[model samples]
Target: MLMKSSKLLKLKFKHQLLMLFMALLTGTTMVSAQELTINGTVVDESGVPLAGANIVEKNTTHGAQTDFDGNFSLKTSSNAVLVVSYFVSFPKNQTTFKTKK
Candidate 1:
């Protein structure tokens, strides 16, 4: 009886540890999905910054306008996919970018 009790306690401890590990893994995965930023630059055909260009994520409200130097930063999640909309010197252009999971 004593031997069996010890074995049961060990099994329970192992199960608890396994549960803890799985919880940690799930948390990490979700956090990674949440913490993501999409960064890019908008330049003209002559390699100059195109200020005031609109960078938008399609089907969502997240958006950012290009800075004076054509730099833009937009925060997003793992499921976010950007659809940039802007007008350059030539015409209207649309671009797509995906956030890393």
Candidate 2:
């Protein structure tokens, strides 16, 4: 009976450690999936900032517009694709950018 009790205690300790490890792994994964902030500037062919350019995350409604200095910032997941659009006197121009992992 004493030997069996010791073995059961060891097994319970091992199970608790396994559960703790799994919980830590799950928390790390959730943290990685959290949103990340992205910042960039839109520029025209003349190396000038393009103010009021629209920046949108691909496949999602999250977006932001460039300010007067042609700078914009938005939050998205890792390795996201962004669609950028701007128009002046001519037709609207569009481009795509991919965020780094």
- Clash counts per candidate, in order, are 0, 0
Question: Would you give me the overall lDDT of model 2?
Answer: 0.83
Residue 38, candidate 2: C-alpha displacement in angstroms: 0.9
TM-scores for all candidates: the values are 0.54, 0.58
Candidate lDDT values, in order: 0.77, 0.83
Model 2, span 1-101: residue lDDT tens? 99999999999999999999999999999987777888989888888998898888888998999999999999876766777788756455444545565
Off by over 4 Å in 1: 1-32, 87-90, 99-101
TM-score of model number 1: 0.54
After best superposition, candidate 2 residue 97: deviation in angstroms?
A: 6.0
